[model samples]
Each structure stands twice: as C-alpha cells, then as structure tokens.
Target: MIAFASFAQPPQDAIFPRHHPDVVDDMDVDLGEDDFERGYQRLTCPGEPITSSQAFMRGHGTYVDNEEVIASVAGTIERVNKLVTVRAVRSRYNPEVGDLVVGRITEVQPRRWKVDANSRQDAVLMLSSVNLPGGVQRRKLESDELQMRTFFEDGDLLVAEVQAFFADGAMSLHTRSLRYGKLRNGQLVTVPPALIRRLKSHFISLPCGVDLILGLNGYIWVSKHMSQSQQEGDAFDGEAVYSNRNDEIDGATRIAISRVSNIIRVFGAHFIPLTDTLLLEAYEWAVEQEGDVRDLLQEDVGDALVATVTAHN
Candidate 1:
C-alpha cells in the first residue's frame, strides 16, 4: 500500500524556496557530497530509515517508527533545520496563499463559485470577493447576488490570486485587482505543477504578441496580448469583464499564440521549470528554424529545440 502525503509549506530558508522573494530565478538545489554529510540526502525509498526522531522532526512523506523517522514515499529528501520531508517526484498541485492561479468554474452556488484549481479540493470564490461592473469598491447588493451567474457562471475560466484559506484548507480566491478576471481569447494548457516556479510575476508577454498566465496550479493561459490602455484605462469597458465573446484575432496572432503554447508544452514534457527568458529564447529558435508550428512537437525537432534553448543554461 502506498501513502500519499499531504502538502506542507517549506521553511523560509529551505532549498525549495517557493516563499522567498530573493530567489527569483528557476534553480536546482545541488547537494554535493559535503552537503550529504550534513544530513541532506538526495533521495529516499519507502520504509528506509532517515534519522532518529529525537534528532529531527518528521515532515511530509515521512513517518515515525521505532523511534526513527522513516520514508513513507519514494522521492527527493528535503531538510529545513530539524525538519525533514520527501518531495514526491510527481504529485498533485500543492497550493499556497498568494499564489496566482488559473482555474475553471466548476459550480455556481448561492453566493460563491466553486473553482477547480487542480488542488485536493475545489477553491471558493465568494461573491463579495469579486469586483462588480461599476467599480472596485462598490458594495454587493441583493441584486448583485441574484446576478452572480452573470459575473461568473459554470465553465468560465478565470485568473485569480489565492487570497486566503478556509478552516478546512479550501482556498479563498479574489479578483479585486484589474489583472484578475475572466480569461478569454486564449487556450489553456495543463502541465506538471512542479514545473512552475514561484517567480516575481506570473504574467508574461512574449515579443510575438502573446500573453501568458503561468498559474501555479499548472493551468497555463496562452492568449493574445491586450494593450495597457485596453486592459486598465479609464475608457476600458467594465461590462466586458464577464463577456464571453472573444475579440477578433488575426491569423498571425493566432499562429504566434499556438507556437508559444507548443513551446511551453515541449519544455514541460522535459520537466524543465519555465522562465520568461527561456521561453523567449525558445520562441526565437522556433521561428529561426522556419518549421511549421506543429512540427515543434515532432520528436526529433522537439529534442533539437530543447537542446538548443537549454545549451547555455
């Protein structure tokens, strides 16, 4: 029988520095021989003894047995001071507060929307937490509650921030900011959540006129770029926030969006943590090769692209 471990937040100074602001780049924590001597083993298997419980506290992917901390899963071992955990090589998305996520509305309730954010449970987006048509600070009237579906109905996609967590660990989401709202003029791509690193900003715009929303939950939004004025100016249409209609997209822009999306898939398939710089390079390489956008997925071509883009990294 295999045990699936629950998610735990890494310590402030842990190698998996998801919560740290200083480490902005995608990085691999290299544990050398000297580091292993200091109790930082690279991997562990089930039932393997890790350390004495008296000397270290057992964390996720570990259990206390016979006064010793034993691995409960096969994965890389992570240590933070006296705490030890094994991060599974492949697992469901582990969410944290303040994470930017792209999610789909699964169910519309009385005053909230249930969003499937690829977590253990669906997240909640309260009616009070979203911005109404008129303005950001407007109070939610009874009429607004009645018209909640108009703002966010089932099957709609949105980009939002993880505002807080409920008593039961369900995430509370909010779209109060102008940047967070219904997603349109794009396609969604699903990848391993581990491939998305916590960066300074999840929103990325490539030179090819495509915008990306790198959801920490592994849902990626590839869409046409909207200018700053069109997105946030005084003349921006407030009612369009919930409009399901997509604007007219030209052929060139559509191809660019598809190309960017395919490149992301290639990187994800290789288990590479994506970054803005790496994506831009990949795009340039693809265009220079003059291969059809669909050709990027060809095994030989994809391998070549990945090798070229990551050669210097």
Candidate 2:
C-alpha cells in the first residue's frame, strides 16, 4: 500500500509529433511513383505542417506555429522562391491589378458605381474611368454625372479591368478600353474563382459560334461569337459600347451558348480548372455524344465528360 506503482511517460516525440517524415519540405510532396510521374500538386489541410518555418517564408492561406509552417486552409501548396502559400480549393475572387473581371453594378454613387466582382467587397468603377459615348478620349463632364445610369445602372453587368486599389483594399475598376464595357447578348456563369486559369487572353471563341469571357473573378460571359469587325470598337459608333439591346441571336447560336454554359457548369462541379483548349475539346466531346444540352448536368454524363476531357490532357 505504501509503495505506489509508477507509470512511464510517453516519449516527447510521441506527445507532440511533427509532420510525417515523407512530407517533403518543398512545394511538392512525392506521392507514390505513379502519382509523382503525373506531377500532382501537394494538397494540404488545416493544421497540417508544410515545412519548417525557418526554412521557408509563409504566404497567404498559411501560418507559422511552433516553428513549422502550417496550412491554414485546405488547398494546393505552392512555392515561389523561398515563400510557400496554399491556394484554396474554393474561395471568393482575390483581385489583382490588370485583371479582367465581369461584375454586376450593385450601387451607383455620385462619381463611381459599386460593382459586385465576386470579391470581399464591392469594386468601384469611376465615371472618369469609362469611355464616353461620344468619344473615347472625351473628358468627363457634369452631364455624364447626371446620366450615369445611362452608362451603367443598378444591376447592369459590365466587363472591366482592375486598375488600382484603395486604402481599404477595395478594387478600382476601369472600362476605358474598347474591349471593356457593358455586357450584352450573353448569359453569365459562375464558378469557383480557383477554376479560372490565367491565359494570354481570357476572351475565347469556340468553333461552335460561341464566345466566352473567362473572367478572373469567376463570372463568365457566354454569348454568341462576334466577328472581328463587330468586336473592334471602330466599326460602329462609340455609343454601341454601352448599348443594352441584344443583337438578335439565332436558335443555333442560343443552343451553342447553352451547351457551352452547361459544359462549364459540369466542369466547375467536378472542380476542374478550365482552359481554352479544354473547353474546345469538351465542347467537341459533348457534341459527339449527341445528348441534349441538359443531359450534360446528369451526374453520369458530367463524370464522363470530365473523364474524357482530362484523359486527352
């Protein structure tokens, strides 16, 4: 009774273990040989240790704890030089300067309009940043302020660029260029911001007479393709840039737009990053299947579409 039984304590390593030794310190972890050959990105979850903090700098979606860089979100791990960051699997748009975005006007202010660009806060599009109806180089005047709605009213959709940022981190948008202006004759498709890949041109024309504006903000514009002349602002009056009327789209073009839009939705559901090449291939594959446009949304069809498109890649 006087002698008490003593219990051995667990080893220090067992009490507070580090990440698995197999987890590489670099951006990529070696999955098995097969996966490694595929060049699969390293995926991480919250609280998972990425690497020793002393060996690397932490970036967004990651935090340092106990001298180790840990993922603060579930995403793909990326490394740039000595900095490590996790790109979230799904998240709202994070605006950057010079990015092309599709947004809806939420509120019209005195000299600026608040745009919902799928960001943390509404983006601002100033009156001075837009091309006047009369001329691109025309200076902003008092009349433009009173007729702001004529340019962009509440809930009107537009395509613009990220010009700058405010002290509060809100984005400032500009539609000064001919390519950027009111969106018309199109339907909008929304997907996870992470799925839209950056390319030389976000505007894509499919072979099926469909045009796509793959906004970096995750708002896509799918519409009937316009000819080179129509796309160039010089072909018509500058007022055409802000025209709200839809150009009479034919039945065939409407069907094409619907098919492409559905294909994109399917891909988004499967969490596939979209590219122009992939969209073209997927469109062809969908047509070859001879299924109705709505059929693409069927789980089985969607899976097959994704599988087929990915196999080619």
Candidate 3:
C-alpha cells in the first residue's frame, strides 16, 4: 500500500545562523547535506541541473542544457533505470489507458461530448462509447443521436475510463460498463491531482453510509452508498444506470457525505497524499472532536488534524 505521508518543512533555525560570533562555527556546519540526505528529499527547482547527459537520459519535465539534464518544472526527481524525470508536485492530470476519471461535460458535439478532466485539452466522450438507455447491447440509431442529450447533456458529470487518444494527444473516454455512468446522490470535491494515490479500487464505500469515487483527475465524488442488490438487479434496466436523478438521501447519509468531503478537503490543504487508511483515520479523529463538520476547516483544527494524521502515517 502506498503511504499518504506529508513531508514537513525543515526547521528554519537549521538553515540560518543563530549565533554569528564565530565564523568557524558556521563554516564547520556542513550545509551541503540537507533534508535530501535524510529520508525526506528536497524539491528540485525549475532549471536546476539534475544529472549529466552521459549518466542519464532525459525524461518528462526535463530538458537538455549544455550536456546536463535540467529540470523544466519544480518537482521531485524520479529515476527509472537510466532515465530521469521530474514529477510536478501539482499538475493537471495526465490520462493513461484504463485510468478511471470523473469529468464534466463541457459541450455536446455531433457524436461526442467534450469533457473537462483537468488536463491541458478537453477529453472526448464518444456517443458509441456509452450504453444506451434501452439495453446493454442496443444499437445507437440516428434517432438516438438526435436524443443524445437525454443520456448526457451539457454540464453533466460522469465517470469513465481512458479508451484512446487523438493525434493531437487529447484523450478519448468511454463509459460502457454499469460502473461507468452519470454520478448522482453525490457532491464533488476538488483537490490536487497528485494527492490521490493510485489504488487497486477507486470506488470506496465507508461504513458510515457514504460512497467515494476517487478520480485520477482530482474530482472526488462523495455520495450515499448503495448495495449490490439495490443497484445490480437487472442489466436491462438502463434507467437505473443512466438516470441523472439522485436517489432519496436521508439526513444521516447527508451528514456522513459532508463529513467525508470535509476530511478530504483537510487532507488536501495539508498537501498530504490521500489513501483509504489515511481517510478513515482522519474521519475517526474528526468524529472524536465532537464538533460540527465545518469545524475541520478551521486553521487550528486543520493543523492539529494534519499533525496527528501524519504522525500516525
């Protein structure tokens, strides 16, 4: 499992001189060894020299400069074999094949819907990619094309997988399975895409009667949990899968959803990588506080939550 640990900043006193009486004392301190030497590595600044051309091949976020590989973005240096790359601490999501993402429909074209997935270019959701409201294997006729908005219209949010890419590098998305469709009974939360670590399953159901969809593009969906029997009765029932309306939500479930959303917001503010374990721990801690869910957003409370959760991590 990937750890959602936060990197704490180094002490200011360690970086600057406190007593200036002795020049030898300052000179004797080895300033070259920083947090990078320790377990927590330092971030590489833009244009910082990373390695020699003969030693490592240039990768993403790096450029060749005078036979030396330099960082093109401020991020952490990642080395894979002889290739060196820099992963920006915060960047737009880069879609990979089979990556599950939640996106909002920006425009409805002739046979495709333009989606915003927090990338440089909008992703394309083709009409043929979705299962029509009649049956799983139903053919999409020209009449179906005229009523395409009935399935997904402008400003609708849906979860899908990266199917392919255009020549210009824009991603093409698909939603053919029951698991990939319109999102309802939920609220969306935005965070840094980097905070959401890759997991075996992005769909998470908490015991508190809330369900979570961790999108690779940092679009999180927190909603009421539904049982298999409630949702998986008949594949022929397209309304169950494609309906834009949300199921009836109770007061308890609503509170649980808000609580979980707030917990995610707190984690994002601390720049902590998000994982199932970390979210559960933070939720429990927040509940123990015996305060309103909104209280977690307070500066002092957020700090305490980060410190406690990171300590446990």
Candidate 4:
C-alpha cells in the first residue's frame, strides 16, 4: 500500500463542508509563495511529484490533475487518494457549473426552501423551480404558491443537482417533473455530497422496490416504481432480499428491508466513483450494525422528512 501524503492550505477546509466558516461555494483562496514547503507534493502523476499546498473537500476522494480542486477551499488532509484521487471530505468548496448532489431541507421560506447542499449557504428552491404535475390543467398554475405546491417545509430531505452558482453564492434547484416529486414509502439518508454522481440525475433503489431520482440542485424524489413497465421488476417470490432461510416471514422481511436500505444508502449515488473494494468495505461495515433499516433512516436522520413522508403515506 502506498502511504500517500496530502498537503493543503489552511483556508481550504471550509467550503461546502458542514464544518468550518468563511468557506463559501465556488470561492477559491490562493496560497502564498511560502504557503507550501519545498518538495512535499510528491508526484502521484506517474513522473511528476505534486505537493498539496491547499486542500479542499478533504474527506471525500480527490481527483488528480482533474482540476476539480483547482479552486481549493481549505482543510487538514485526512486520507490521501490513490495516485489520481485523494480523500478530501471535510473541505468546503462551492458548487460549480455542473455538480450533482443529495441534500436535506433545513429551512423553508414563504415561497422557497433552503437546503443544506453540503455547502456553507443553503441552496434555494424557488416556486418556479418546481414543476407541479397533474394540476387542473394538467400542469401547475402560475398563481400557485410554490411554497405550498411542493410542500418542502423545513426539515424535509431531498436529492438535487447543481445548476449554476448565484452571485450571492447560492445554488438553485428544480423539481417540477415526475422523476423529481415528493418521496414516499421508503427511507432517506445523507452522505458526503461530493460522492454523488450526475448520471440520469438520480439512482437510489431501496428494498421496498423504490427507485429514486436525485436532482443536482438538491431535490430528490423516491417512489415504489419508476414507471408502469418497471412495475413487475420488483416482483419478489415472497422474499425481496432473496433469502432462502426458513425464518418467519416477518423476520425475513425485516432482514430484507435492512439490507436494501443500507446498500442504497451508502452506494446509491456512486457509479464508478468509489473503488469496488471501498464500496464492499462500506457495505460490510453498514451490515455489521444493521438491525432495523428503518431505524437508520428515521426522524433521527431527517426529522422534517419523517413528517413529510408520514403526511404523504
């Protein structure tokens, strides 16, 4: 195993990260001439050794020469990535032009909802950003109060993608389509937003046969099925977990639910993002304490979410 060393600026630790202040989104602070020492940025680039002068996104993995961290925020290095990548989770960097994410609702205003988009300022969800379907005219009316239509009150959990950065460092979001509606019937969890990928907007699948659509701007929708054609896809021969044990039906159901939620919770958004070994390790670790999967994704995890889900269910 290679013992990768990570060097970074002190200010790089505050962006997008839940910890630290002064680290706003998309904002990059520079490193002075003596900011870094002589020759510590080893070459993970095959031949050229690169020393980390400023580090951001400290815990999540780092992408090599990829320019993702070009705008480093600040932080202490925790785990260095393998060659092309390093762990930079605790760092706070802003949402760029095209970054996808999963977030939790922290505050809801008169006509908007504020989300903790894994950033310093909570992302905004304007009434117009939401696409309310099945309205009287087969679409949402313009006069509808966005705040009431989506009902994304405080404490709700959502999955969203980043569209563009606001001049005030705020990111915008949308959820006006079927794929991005209110979540129901399953569980919701949060992870380091940096790990979320942008493929198809979302990819969360739970044990209850639910498919998820995560918005890059911080809106998330989850349901039992993706569509009519996929309805039968969840067909289980009495055991969704595929267990062949002779345990009681209820016991088996409980086990299956736990397994399903954990798998999606930890690996839902990562598609070719994390190493297979790391994913397996994560799954194993989650299983170790897996008892009631619902317990893991309850009000304890998202208080406002439980209320929203309960109201819908």
lDDT of 2 by residue, 137-232 (tens): 767889889999998999899999999999999999998776778888889999899888888999888889998999999999999888777777
lDDT of 1 by residue, 147-197 (tens): 898888899999999999999889999998888899999999888999999
Off by over 4 Å in 1: 1-41, 234-236
TM-score of each: 0.86, 0.83, 0.86, 0.47
Predictions ranked by lDDT, top down?
Answer: 2, 1, 3, 4
lDDT of each: 0.86, 0.86, 0.83, 0.45
Q: What CA root-mean-square deviation does each model show from the true structure?
A: 10.1, 11.2, 6.0, 15.0
Per-residue CA lDDT of candidate 3, range 169-260, in tens? 99999988767788889999999899887889999988888889999989999989987666555335866666777789999889889999
lDDT for model 1, on a 0 to 1 scale? Answer: 0.86
Higher-ranked by TM-score: 1 or 2: 1
Better model by TM-score, 2 or 3? 3
Candidate 3: how many backbone clashes?
A: 0
Error of 3 at 267 (Å): 0.4
Order the numbered candidates by TM-score, best leading.
3, 1, 2, 4
